[model samples]
Target: MPKPEPTELSRPYWDALREGHLVFQRCSCGNAWLPARRHCPHCLKPEPRWERSSGKATLVSWVVYHTAYHPAFESRLPYNVALVQLAEGPRLLTNIVDANEALVADAPVELQIEWEGDTALARFRLAHVTV
Candidate 1:
């Protein structure tokens, strides 16, 4: 399997993830971006800077993949992958710890960092959600 690629535009986001912080690009025009970009979508200006988020969110939707499309995900089958609307104003797609179906949609969650050497990927889990 191959490693994931990070473009220059997304370096800050990936870097922040490694440090256990959920940072988003905040534009001077008052817009916040997800999946980080270099220019502000609203103003089309280089008015973006990384800002830390509160790390809180609500599960908007998710899928339980019984199959793995990549070798890296093969051992982690049946994991809950989801899109969460963070308190910071961006919707992030991440994973949740394997929990019961009852805790699927609309559950509150928080961001966590999955470290791989010098890099880390952002993952999420049920916040205060008891097993």
Candidate 2:
């Protein structure tokens, strides 16, 4: 697995995830986003504050990849790359773990942070699926 290189702007996000907290930037205009942007995509205001997520989300769309575009990912072939809309309104590109079959659109999901080596990532699972 590849490691994440966090820039200064994205450090807070990665750091929060490492502490088992999912956070995003929220603008005064009622917009929230991920991947750490300095300005709100909607209002163009700077310094959006970091807010913790409820860890709740909905599956918007996804595709199962049977082939790895990179050799490092070959061992994890047949994975799902999903677009999940967080309850706070930001959509994120993430993987749906333990999804053996097709996931239904709008299925509720919850955050399940995991580590790749020492790097933490924000992944999710079906709300109904148990650990």
Per-residue accuracy of model 1 over 35-107 as CA lDDT, tens digit each = 8776888899885888999989998988888988887888877777788888878888878764747566787
User: What tens-digit string does per-residue lDDT give for candidate 2 at 36-55?
Assistant: 99999998999899999999
Error of 2 at 84 (Å): 0.5
**What lDDT score goes with residue 80 in model 1?**
73
Candidate 1 yields a Cα-based lDDT of 0.80
CA lDDT of each prediction against the hidden true structure: 0.80, 0.90
The alpha-carbon lDDT assigned to residue 6 of candidate 2 equals 94
Per candidate, the number of residue pairs that clash is 0, 0
- How much lDDT does candidate 2 score? 0.90
- The lowest-lDDT stretch of 10 consecutive residues in candidate 1 is 96-105
User: In candidate 1, which residue pairs clash?
Assistant: none
TM-score of each: 0.85, 0.94
